[model samples]
Every structure is written in structure tokens, then in C-alpha cells.
Target: MTLGLPDHLVEPILSRALARASHWFALTCLAGALLSALSLGLTYEAGLLWMAVLSVLAMAALLVTLSLRPTVVLTIAYLLVGTGGTYLYTTDLLGLPDVFPASNMFLAALPKLALIMVGGAGSGALTGVLWSTAGFVLAETVTVIAAAEAEVTYLPDGFTISACLFLVAVLLLAGTARRPHRAAQSAIHRAVHADQSRLLRQDLDLRALDLNQDTTLNELIALSRARAGPLTENLSGSIRAALHRLRGTDWLTDADAHRVSHSPGADAWLTSEVYLAIERCRDRGLVVDVIGDRSALGRLDPVVDRELGLAVQQCLINVILHAGIVSAEVDIGGDGGIFSVMVMDAGRGFTESETGADRLGLRQAVRRRIKRLGGSVTVLTRPDAGTSVLLSVPAAAPAAAPDGQGTR
Candidate 1:
């Protein structure tokens, strides 16, 4: 049986109980005396009647001291009054037989003894109960046996049987006191440990949250955007500059430069696939030299198939970001599981040192994308010269490759 009182929060209650020990004793004594008075009236015992009277008088004495001294003094008064009251009840008043004559029944006043030991909730009462009950039973049994032999007090066997049940009450009180306190303490320990476990779980969740932020998915994406943006811009500008130079040199006629080299159907396909590429490059000032099969790329369903569209998109992004350009050129060719998208340029090229962020936009964003679609991308470049991206992918083709040319 748990006490059901809060253990950690009970200190103040305990201290107050201790502080008012004398009052508690005095009040309990008064209550016991009234009970004894009733017992005396019922049993017609003059001794018990005086015990009741003396107990009531002791209460008056304790009350008198309350006005004359501090509360602690009142407590001391209660203990004094209680002890005196017990003796008076036993000897001068109640004439109650000493159940434990070799021991002291005064020692068995539970609340009084408990207060003296640990301020009214400790081992004193239990000890007193155990000692007194044991001694009473053994001594009374022996005394009654001897009395029967001597023809002393008239206690029939039936009366003796009923009287001995008092031992049961004493045992009950002792057992009750001991069990609940230990149970309460055990409950408190379990509660504290449960709270600690909950705190540990909360700490782990916080650590996981911390781990997920700042250095995870969002951080990587931000870094990718930063690095990829400028590379795309610079490549476009270089291509446009090369275009003006090529036109001024008269190296290619308008027919040579502007002619669509593929079948009109292929030309439409190429336009569809490469339109975003052209727009992206032009926005950043790159010049595109549309060469070879210009109409071939759009033959596949860029509008219907998302993966194909995204692959085409990344190819253009890569041309702008990774291919250092003099003139951006696309050589679209091949058929059925074999297609090539060559983006030719003039500048410094890829190297082993360009890894991670420096290359994720090109490698992760573009090359890997086309490769996933069962296509391949090759980087052909050298320093101060040129670069070309060869993308060979599987697609059903209509005709052969073309050598188309356009300057933009």
C-alpha cells in the first residue's frame, strides 16, 4: 500500500508535523482520555474514570503554556503532559492492569513515542507497538495460566480467547505503518527515473534535428545554385563574342550560316529540343553555331515525355555552364540507341581537380541526366583551344545526320 502522498514535495508537510508535535500529542492524549472515560463508564472501572479526568486536565495545562511560551514550548508541554497523563491513567486513575508489568505501557503511547523519535512518522511507534504487544501476550498468557491454577480473577476460556485478539490490532497498526512509507519511497524513485528517461529521448530528438539542418539537403542545394549560375553565364558571353568575329571574317555566307541542314521534320524536332537551350544561352550573351543535323533532337516527344525533356534541358544548361565557348555549336546525329549531341566551344577544359561543387552542375545536373536516359556525354577539350560535348542517346530516328549551320 502506497502512502499516495508526494514524496519530494512532502518536506514542508513533514517539517510542519514536526513543529506541531506537542500540539498533536496533547490533542491525541485528550482524545484517548475521552475514549478511556467511555471505556470506564461501560466497564464501571473507577481507575479508568480518573485516567480520563487526568488526561483532560493535561490538555488544560498544554493550553495554558501556549499563551505563556512559543509554539515549540507548547510542543514540549504536550509531551510532558502526555507522559504524565499516561502514568496517571495507568496508576492513579484507570487502575488498568499492567499488561506488560516488566515493561512500561507509557512506552507504548504511540503518537508520543513517534514524536520523540522522528517527530511523529518514524520507527518509534512501531517499535513500541511490537515490544509492548509481544511482552503483553507472553506475560498475560503465563499470568492467566498461573491465575487459573490459583483460582484468581474469573476469566473463562471464552473470555480469554476474545481478549487475546487485541494482539491482532497491535500487529495491524505496526504492519500498516511500515508498508506504506517504503512503498511511497519506491514510487518516487520510479517517477524520477521515468522523467530522466523522457529527458534523454528529448535530447536525442534535438540532436537529430540539429543534424538535419545547416549541413544537409538544403545546404547542398544552395551551394549547387551558387556555383552553377556563374559558369553558365560566362560560357554564354564568350560564345556571342566569337559569333561576331566569325561573321566579320566572312568565313561563312548567310546560306552557309543560316541554312537548316536536316529534313524539315528533323528541323522541327531539333527546334523543339534546343529552343530552351538557345533562349538560355542568348539571355547570357552566348552565340550558338547550329551545325550538323539541326532538326533531329525534337523527333522525340519533349512535350509528352518529361525525362526526355529534362535531359534535353540539362544538355543546354551544361553547354552554358561547363563548355567554355568561342562559338556554341550542336552536331546532332545518329539513330536508334545511337545519337550524338556535340556542343563545340573554344577554351580551357575539364580537369581532375574540378570535382564536387566545381563540377556537380555539369556532371550531376547534365551528364548524369542524359546518361540515365541511356545516352552518353563526352567532354572533348584542351586549354586555350576548344571544348565539345558529345551526347549519344537512344532514340528512333527518321533519317541520317546533317551538316547544318546557323550563327546566333
Candidate 2:
């Protein structure tokens, strides 16, 4: 579900956008192509073949995304190739050094940024940082060249100034154009995926609406505030993440939370509020099999209890709606002072968004919860490959005390 070329072109442009209209690759590609066609006299047979080849390849890549499955991998591969092709094409006309490197910059920058936003930091920081710097440097060089050209004596100063200014203006325009024109945020008529997201949101709203409303916001907040003390049990990260999201969107201020509520017993506090969360999911017909203990032994850690609950619920909702999944499995357990929750579904797993920005439903919901709790999530999903989500949180107390610290 997509709009038209007018809108579709914005996908990559929006990817590398900066604060004050910064990304220049898209503009460079545009101006380069136009100038090349005009200056080359459009007469070289070999050049004509290159043009045809480029057009065919680009179209074929995009076509596969529309007419096939596995859009994530295809999109990533196509974008890399297309970026490289744009650099090569621009180089053929403008002769830039290391065009592939420049294209690789575009290929890396946006997706990497987006990946971080949605919990892909599982890849580690150093690699992500190096790649980001390389992309930005290459992108900047390609863009700045237009404004840095030498003055031409044959051309009038005004004309040269005007031409340079025009070039700057175009780069600026292209630079500004690279904002988040996310597929998740597009005109309904043109959006290839709006309905899918809309459905997922609807499910969440419906569920939230059905919850108990008589509970006080302060009570919920107190429930979320992590206890500071020498404790024997603790909540995990996923539960804490869910709590933060629950407060941010649902609670607003404590006043907003007054109506909705959750009260964790001792068992839930020790095992992870995730245990009870799975029960809620099962009540909604979302669980294929629930395997976990719901009883515990201590005060519930505020952060983990709330977030892990919400994350679990969101995961279930995502599968029910998008995974093409009929059944799922849930496991909540602890190992080495770490409370973990694993959800597996026979549905197709997470697909990297075609444009990079997380979609409105699954990614945003999960990430908001995960990040707020100082936790993380991972998705190993492919078209028809099934989906698996593993969430872990620090436990309240270790089964075996460290050396010389057996007594707390």
C-alpha cells in the first residue's frame, strides 16, 4: 500500500534528514542526473545503455518489494545497490572520488539510526558509531562540493554567483527534504501499511479500555516506583519497560492513572510481573500455551513489573494482528539472578521497515517500554520464518551469594 511516485521518492530522502534540512545525497543525485542528461547531449549509445540498466535495476528492486515477500532484505539490498548506483551515476557525470563509499554512507546512516531507535543496539556501540561517522562525512562531502566549486571566468560573475547559489539552493532543498516521511506516516490513500497499523492500535485501545478504572493513579505510581533497599526479590527489565510506557501514555499524570490499575503480589514481584501478564494475555485468547509460575516472595519492583507486563501484552497483540500467527508459546523463568521472558510464535517475525522508521504499533510500543526501563528487546523474524522475542531483567536477589558475601 503506497501513494504515488511523488510520495514514494520521499522514503530515502526522509531517512537521512537533519535538524535544519541537512541530507544532500538525494539532491545531488537529482541535479547530477538532470545536468548529465542535458550536458551529455543524450547521444552516447553506451551511456544510453547505462541509463536503461540503472532504470531497470531500480525498478526491478522496487517491484520485488511490491510483488513479492521478504520486503525487508530486498529493500536493504536494493537501497545499498541503488545508493551505490546513484553515486556511480553521479560520478559518471560529475566524477566524484570513491562514489561507492558515498553511496555506502547513505546506505548505512539512516537504517543504523533507525536500528538504534528500535532496539538494534544489540549490535554494539563502537561499530554503530564508526559506520555513522563514515556515512555522515561522505554524505557531507558530496553535498558541499556544489557550493565549493571554483569560479568560471567565462561566465558572468552574477551568473556564476547565481549558478552557485542555485546549486546551493538545490542542495539546501534536497538537504531539507530528508525528513521522516515514514511509511508508517503517510496518506492513507498512498500508504501500503496504514491499515495494518491501525488495526494493531485498535486492539491496544480496546484492551486498555477494558481494564479496571477505579484504581488510584498514586497507587499505580507507587506500584511502579522501584524500592530502594536490601531486597530478596526483584522485577525484570521488560516489566519495568512496560510500566514506564503504561505511565507515559496511559497515566499521563497520576490523575490519568487513577482509573486503570495493577497490584502485584509477592510471587509476581520475584518471578517478574511478566508471569501475571501472560495470564492477562491468555484471558484475551492471545496465548497458545502459557508456561510460568505466578507466585513469588517479595515486594514488586515498580519499573520491571509495569513495563514487562506491557511489553508482553504488546508482543501478543502484534502477533495476533500482524504475524499471520495462529498460536504462540510463552516462558517466564529466572537463571543466574536474571528474570527472562521468551515469546515464540509461528507467525512471520519482525521485518525491518522498508524506509527505516519504526511502525506505529509494534516497534514504537515495544521500544518505548524497553528503553524507559533501561532494558532491550530482540526480534529474529523473516517472511514465513516465525518470530521470537526474548526479554531479560535483573532479578532481585541471586540464588548463590558472591564469595565472602554469603550473608547480606
Q: Which candidate wins on TM-score? A: 2
Question: What is the TM-score of each predicted model, taking all chains together?
Answer: 0.30, 0.30
What's the true lDDT of residue 153 in model 1?
Answer: 51
Candidate 2: which stretches are off by over 4 Å?
A: 1-276, 292-300, 353-358, 397-408
The 10 consecutive residues of candidate 1 with the worst lDDT sum are 399-408
TM-score (C-alpha, index-matched) for candidate 2: 0.30
What local lDDT does model 2 show for residue 326?
49
How many residue pairs clash in all the candidates, one count each? 14, 26
Q: CA lDDT of each candidate?
A: 0.47, 0.45
**lDDT by residue for model 2 (244-325), tens:** 6555555333644542455454335436556556644443435357666433313325555666677887887777666654
Tens-digit lDDT track of model 1 for 339-396: 5666676644556255467556556655656655555677766665666667666664
After superposition, candidate 1 runs with Cα above 4 Å error: 1-267, 303-326, 397-408
Instruction: Give the lDDT of residue 31 in candidate 2.
Output: 39
